[model samples]
Target: MAGGLLGTDVVTQIGIIVRDIEKTSQAFADFFGVEKPKWFLTDTIDKTQATYRGEPCYGRAKLAFFKLGNLDIELIEPDEHPSTWREFLDQHGEGVHHIAFVIQGMQEKITLLAGRDMPLVQKGEYTGGRYAYIDTVPQLKVAIELLEND
Candidate 1:
């Protein structure tokens, strides 16, 4: 609720899990009357160094993004690997996965959230930034993603 935890209250992105990113991305484009965004695969383990529940995970996903105003709508199609995305899609089916906030200190935020019972589920690095998913469903009914850009 306060900047003390997340550094800011502004949500920059909303990620949705889907079985087929191409189809879903088109759906969004049609509904919004925007250009269909191309979907791409996330970085590999060598590049991302992704982890799941504190263990190295080789999971990767296809991602497509649509920017509207200041918010981005992300569509994710997870591979059959161990990851927060895959787990969410398996347990809850395709739907909203996480709401992301751009933050400063990712480790500190992750620690603070963990202290409040929101444990880190998965984490990985992107081209110019990093991301972490926190299991906040128990309290917020949705996972929270922390994005730190370099």
Candidate 2:
């Protein structure tokens, strides 16, 4: 198989979809013997953009991140919206939703994946970075999220 446009194999984060961010984050912290992860509401995300099945849609999630070694363990609680997270939870239940990789030249990478028939599912910007989720479940059995941090 060919390598991705990012030209790397390292996973930056493993995102898990949940029904409740607070409960799930607490449980993860307890199981891992770490402090409770901080939560961020999707409504606070800036420059957010997303599409579902090629149509514009609105979705929100409450998210928490716990750094584990070189990668983060991300928990996402889908809000009342039609988003990829919500769709995943509805179709597959609570589980691993996507694996993330940090990359440079995000637009070029997105174009490359889109050329390969992997459409962008969702995207948003945060404090110092932005992220895009690509729909790759049919071929890879999981979505791929690309991150570009400033």
- By lDDT, the best candidate is 1
Candidate 1 Cα deviation (angstroms), residue 51: 0.5
Candidate 1 per-residue C-alpha lDDT over 115-134 given as tens digits, one digit per residue, 9 for 90 to 100: 99999999989999999999
Candidate 1 clashing pairs, residues 3+ apart or interchain: none
List candidate 1 stretches off by more than 4 Å.
Answer: 1-4
lDDT of 1: 0.93
Stretches of candidate 2 above 4 Å error? 1-3, 44-46, 53-56
Please report the candidate that would top TM-score against the real structure: 1
Error of 1 at 50 (Å): 0.8
